[model samples]
Structures are given as C-alpha cells and as structure tokens.
Target: MMLIKRIAVALALWFTAGMTPLKAETTLLFNVFVPRSNNFHEVTAQWAEEVKAATNGEVTIQFTAGNMAPPPEQLEAVKSGVFDIAFIANIFLKNKAPLLQATMLPWLVDKSENASIALWRVYKKHIEPKAPFPDAHLLTLFHWEGGQLASITDTKINDIKELKSRKMWALPGPPADLLKTLGMSPVATPAVQVGEMVSRKIVSGYMGIAPEIARDFKAGPYTKTITWFPRSVTSTSFSVFMNQEKWNTLSDKNKEAIMSVSGEHFAAMAGAASNKEMQAALDEMKKNGVEIVPANPDFYKKMQAAAQPQFDAMRKEGERLGVNVDAMLEDFIKESESIK
Candidate 1:
C-alpha cells in the first residue's frame, strides 16, 4: 500500500511539473462582414499573417465577418474594448468623430495612390489625437475612386439634364447632400437592397464603386447604362483600431510590427484593390449593354461649383470646432499632387 501511494504521488508531481501554463499572448479580432473574396479582406489577412510571423507567435489575430455586432455599434465597442481590434467605417462613426469626415467630403482628392496616402498622413498628424479616437488606436485609412452613376431605366442619364427629376439612390448622410445638389431626390436605400429596389422599379438608378457592382452584387443585370460622371468619391475609410488597454499591454516591438504594416502600406493595397475592382466593374457593365458616357467637362465644372457651398459649410463647421479646415484641404491637395 505504501509503495503504491508513493508511486501515485510521484506521478502527479511529475505531470504537474511537465505541464506549462498557457502564455497570454495578444490576439486581435476584426469584424470583416465584407466578402473574403474582396481585396480588402485579402490584404487584411496578409497583414495579420505578417504580424504573426514578425511576432514569432507572440501575437495573433482573428478576423470574423457579419456583425460580431451590428456595424453602427463598432465604434463605441472598440472604445469600450469589446474586441481587441476593430475595422470601422470612418463615415459610419462620423457622429462620434465628425472631424474625420473632413477628408470624406465629396471630390476632395484626385483618384490616385498619392491622394490616399496624403489624406491618411493628414489624419494621423492632425485628426487621430483628437478627443473622439482617444480610447482607441488609429491604424490605416484609404479611399475608393469616385464611382460612376448606374441606371436601370429605359432612358439613360447621359447628361445632368437627364439626371434631373430622376429617382436616384443615396447611401444616407452626405450622399443625400450630393444628390440634392444634382437636383435629384434622394432614394434612401442601402446597397444591399439595391437589386430588389431596381428590379421592382422602386428606384431608377444608383451609384457605387465598380468593383462592388461587378464582383459581389452582379449589378450588370439590373442597370442598363453607366454614366461616367466621376460623381462624389465615396471611399470607406478603415481603421485597424486596438482596444486601449490591450494595446498598452503589448510590448513596444509588437506594436511597431503592427504599425509598420499599417497606414500608407495598407492604403496602397486598398487603392490597388479599388482600381482593379473598378476596371472589372466597368467591363461587366459594358457586357450588360450599359452605355458608358463620360460626363461633359462643362457639366462637371458646374456641379463642382455648386458642391463648393457644401464644402464651405463643412469648413466653417470645422473652424468652429477649432480645426484648420482650409489648411488641411490645402495640405491634402499638395500631398496628392506630390504622390506619383
């Protein structure tokens, strides 16, 4: 009996000694509802892999799509550390951080890699440190090129005159403002519902980035004409935000590894994805008998002139908030031009 007891005691001690406690390494979770097939998802996955490799397993990340929570709640969730990290839409959280919307103003920058980089740089320098994002870390920001106007109606909208009195789709907020300026009534419809609405004739037309129309939604069947008006550029600015406490717990080396893969590097990937998607969408539209008509230069100039008042109103609001809106715009233009 004594011999058996001794053996049992020895084995238990040995087992305990050999067992190692699970080390608490940092892990980030991203809410990626957009299809994994999309370019953003691909690049984000690459970024995660790079971080894991760089940390040598010291840090890990997990990405989940389709509303880990609702999309609108993501901003406050990140601030409260509901997830270790979040990929948020800049405009969706504009109520929480209106200053960020300055860059999102329609037609602010030209559609080139330089434009994106410049805008992000300005945000990092002047915008991130503001009160709104104080609870989280700001990572990358980028924009999509302005998408063309697409219509399902028998009458094509080849000119501003044709667009007048057209029931056009608007993605809420500033988009409505843009439609109003164009003398069109805002059709308050989400992108997901676009197919049903168009097919039912609830709306005559809508505008969106080409890639979205081509790859994900198959917009060719619904829309018959693609008016090549480089309407308001609507880029969804994404941020790789970290929960404040979790971020503070990370070692400096790990933080630097994550940040290095962020900002302009991610912006570049985003821009490339957007460019490719746009081309693909255009091709799809053409196959569907969608006549592509470039907007007249005179018309474009006139629209810009009208939209200028809205821009001025925004700038004035920024000034009231003590932000240098004019300087930011000037800096953005300068940086965009400089990007080759």
Candidate 2:
C-alpha cells in the first residue's frame, strides 16, 4: 500500500508540472493613430520591443495603427478598456486634464528631449494626482522640440507682422491662442486637411512640424518657405496611458519590465526620433527649393513679447486648477535645464 501511494503522488506531480506553468503569458494591445513611418508610431514599436525583451516574452505588445481611434476618443477608450494602451495628446483633453497645460506653456524647453524630460518629471510630481487621464495609469510624458510656421504663400513669415495678414492654420489650445494674439486669424484645420486647405486657398500658412506639414500638405508643391522658432513659440505634449484595470492585473515582474523602459528614457528616445524626422523633412524642403527661414532673434523677441499674455493666462488657469503656477513653472524649467 505504501509503495502504491508514493507512486500515485509522483505520477500526479509529474503530470501537473507538464500541464501548467506558474505565469500566463500576456500580450497587450497598443493603439496608434498614425502610420508606421510617423515618429510616434516608430517610438511605440521600439517601446514594445524593449518591454518584450525585458520580460523575456512573458509580455508583448500588438500594435494596431491606422487611426484605431481618434485623439479625442482616446481618453475614454483607454479608461473603458477599449485599448490596453494608447497615447493621449494633451491638446485633446483640455477639460479632462486641465492642470497638465502648465508643462505645455510655450518656451519652457528648447529641445524635444528636454521638453520630454521636463514633462515626465512634472506629471509624476504635480499633475498625476489631480489630472484626469480618467481610469488610466500614467506611464510617460514626452514632447517634440518645438513647432514652427510654414507657408505656401509668396510672402515669407519673417516677423509677426507677416503672420498678421495671413490666415494661418492652428490646432487647439496654445497654438491657436499664440496665432490669435499675434494678429493672425487662426483657422482650425485638421492636420490631414492642411495640404488641401492650402491648395484651395483656405489658409495661407500653418504652425506645425515640417514633417507633419510635408506628410499632409505635400509641402514641396505648396510650401515656398519654412519658419523655425523656440520653446516660447510652441511644443506638443503626449502621454502614455494604460487602462487602470489592465495595469492592476500586471504581475510585479512584468510591471517592472514595462516601467524599466519608460519614464525619462522613453521620453528622450521618442523626442530624439521626432527631432530627426523634423530635420529630414526640412532637408527635403530645402532640396525642393522651399526656403528654410530661421526666425531671427528680432522675430523671437517679438514673439516672446506677444506670447507673454498667453503664458500669463496659462499660469492663471493653473492656479485656478489648484496648482501653484509660478512655482510649478520654475520647477519645470529647472528640471528641464538640469537634464544634460
């Protein structure tokens, strides 16, 4: 009887061992709104690869680009578990994440990598608790170096005055405000439509990245001039968001794996890619005889002056949102400058 009992137990243990492991593999769904060549899309792919390698394939990410969801709808989709992961551009969530606007106040950081680090630090410290990512877990924050004005018109945007007479395309939030303050009529146009709008005479020019402009507007055909500016002019803020429920279910080992490649590191990676893409587009513009015009210091000073009130308003809004705007601004800039 003893020999039979021992043999039965050994058999059961051996069979169960082969049938099940302790951890189930997980593959997360990553949603992107742009094409593979797009900077953000490229970064997302890298992030997924890093996470998978770090986890030894315990976890993986399946990317579904092609506008799986629009920016405005991303917040709710993430919270509702429509996507396990998504990137939310801050511009689309003004009412939802009002406090985050502080980091985006133009002219804060000079480089995309700098802005990316600053945003990650600030969000973790100040905005995460009060900000509305609505049922999502904040992963990382990043931004491009800065955006500039590009025109298809015969006249160049050498100064604010040139912008005044032009019907300029603007996105929501600070970009629209900056142009309006500088005396340009801000026409709210979807990025996909910028090329068509310019061709049809709906807008004289636009304030965005050269890469984005070339992608949508085929700048070589329509753009005769490109304008560059500093942080005081414009930048974009984007955050990596995951459904809270999904995040909670991740094992500690897997959590660490995902986060291992996130934060400031991810920010720098994405920002650098964006900067490279911008430079490439500018080079193409030059080859096509599109005049690449650097905004003179005179123009910069004028824009800084014109942009002051907008900054003030952003600070006031920050205060109303219960954050100490002045102090946050100083800290944000300090963190940005402190990063090499």
Candidate 3:
C-alpha cells in the first residue's frame, strides 16, 4: 500500500509539471562602437529598455562593454552573427551604401533631428528598393548635427579668400573634398585626434565638426573662433542594424515590439539628445572665450558652388543605380524643412 502511494504521488507531480508552460526569453548582444559616456550610447541604452518593456521582458539587450570589432568591420561582424546588433558608420560602407552619402553632403539639413528623419523617409521611399545591405536588417538611420569651421589662429575666416592655402583638418569624404576644392589644404583627421593636432599646430583649423565635439575632444582651448554656416558644411551618417538570422528568430509579436521603439522614433530621440548636448557645449565654449563668427554671404555662396561637383557626382552614381537622385534630394530637403 505504501509503494502504491509513492507511485501515485510521482505520477501526480509529473502531471503538474507537464501542465505548466515554459517561459521564453531572448537576449541580444549589442556591440557599442562609441564610448560608454557618449550621447549615442546612452540613447541606445534607453532604446534597449524600451524594447524590453514593449516585449514584457521577453526580449532584452546586452551591451558588449566595448567595441567588438573595428568601426568599418561592424557591419560584417553583425552579418556573421558575431554580434546580434551593431552601430555602423555609413561612411565606412561607401562602396556598398553609396546612396547613404546623401546625408553627408554639404549645406544639407541644419538640425540633426531633421536630417535623421528626412534620411529615413527618403531612404524608405527611394533607397530601400535598391536592396542595399541585404545581409542585415536595418533598424534606423541617424546623422550628427551640421558641422562648422573652427580656427585656432587669430585670423578668423571672414571671407572665402581667407581659406585659401590654409591647412585645415576635415573629416574624410565630402567635407575634406569640399575644403580641398575651395583652395584649403585639407588634412583628414579623426575626431579624437583633433585636439592633439591643434595643440601641435599641425593644422590652422578644422571643419566638419560640431561644437559638442570641440568640447568633448578638448579642442576648445586651441580653438579661437568658429565660422558658423547657416546650413552646416557636412555631417556624418550612422546606421543601427541587426543580424538577419537573429532578427528572423524573433516572433512576430516580439519583432513588432522591438520596431515600435526603432525607425524614425529612435532617430528623433538620438537627435534631440545630441542637440541638447550641442547647446551645452556651445555655452561652455563661449565661457572659454571662443567667438562664433557667422559666415560671410559671399563665402557661403562660394561654398555652395564648390559643392556642386559633389552633387553632380552623386547624380551620376544614382543614374548607374537607377535611382532618381534629384527626387531623393528634393524629398529629403522638403521633409527636413517640414519638420520643426
């Protein structure tokens, strides 16, 4: 009788276990290429929290603490499943994502928010159909605020003629190209090294950087004046994406939840955060006695003219890709202006 009782109890326990449902949980590995204190990284952490909330804890993101790969290798890292998600600078993928260069063109959009939103809308309408980066799932696109020219020398840039023969550090691509075309000796420099380059007097000034960059990179002390353009000279573009296989593993419900906090929403959030930082940085730079000089009308016009060849080149490339580059540009500008 005792043996029968023991068997009955075992059967009951087994039945109870079988009736209970198993919990499903997923954690995605996120590769952070930027510094932990950077605005972009902070915003991304918030985005991860939103995703978790939206999924009711079914999905979560785990940051890798530091970069898992080089900046240019991030896309491939995600595609190969080394990381489930990564932040990729579009400039590095110029050969594969040429159309993305539109966001980096001279005198385009002024605010980061507007530029990001416009890029997403235009990309969906025009560039998406081209099947760029078919190996990964793009979550959203974003760009930094327009960059201004900063000079360390006493002679501020009041006219385009003043820029002639002056060695200036610029971010590679359109910014450097435009500076070179305008008769300035352009040296390609990374943001982190700008302060060192300046202190060493390697260059007279630097272009294609925002005020926040100057503040964070410790370039303010060496920077005497900033030549502000109504529409910034150029900006850098970035894309947040996930591995195709990992994205496919997500249930439809979870996928929807994740996307709810992505796309244009993510873009706007990132831009607004950066804008706030930019304002604070500007205030700090002013306290340090860095003068903000407005660009002369003739100088601005000259810059626009020098950028014409860049636009033309983009159009030619668009023709090869069967995309109407003009339409995309018009839509991007219109969408950007329409936003507040």
Q: What is the C-alpha RMSD of each candidate to the true structure, in Å?
A: 3.7, 3.1, 1.9
Question: Best lDDT goes to which candidate?
Answer: 3
Candidate 1 segments exceeding 4 Å error? 1-24, 109-113, 129-134, 208-211, 230-233
TM-score of each: 0.84, 0.87, 0.94
Tens digits of lDDT, candidate 3, 1-340: 9999999999999999889675599999999888777888889889999999999999999999678899999999998888899988888988888999876899987888888988888999999997465579999998887789988999997677778757788877888899777766687878888888888998988888899887788788898999999988888888999999999999999999998999999988887887888888899899989999999989899888999989999998899888999999999999999998
Clashing pairs in 1: none
Of the two candidates 2 and 3, the one with more favorable TM-score, higher being better, is 3
Candidate maximizing TM-score: 3
Q: Rate the local accuracy (lDDT) of all candidates.
A: 0.69, 0.75, 0.88
Residue-level lDDT of model 2, residues 1-340, one tens digit each, is 9999999999999999899667578888878876666778778888988998988888899976456677778878878777788887777877777766666666665777877887787777776655545568877878875666788887888876677878888765677777777666687766666677778888888775445545545545788887766553567778788888888998998898889898888988988887787678767777878887778889878877776887788777777767777777787889878878
Q: How much is the lDDT of residue 165 in candidate 2?
A: 76
Model 2: lowest-lDDT 10 consecutive positions: 208-217
lDDT of 1 by residue, 71-108 (tens): 66675787776666667767676666777677666666
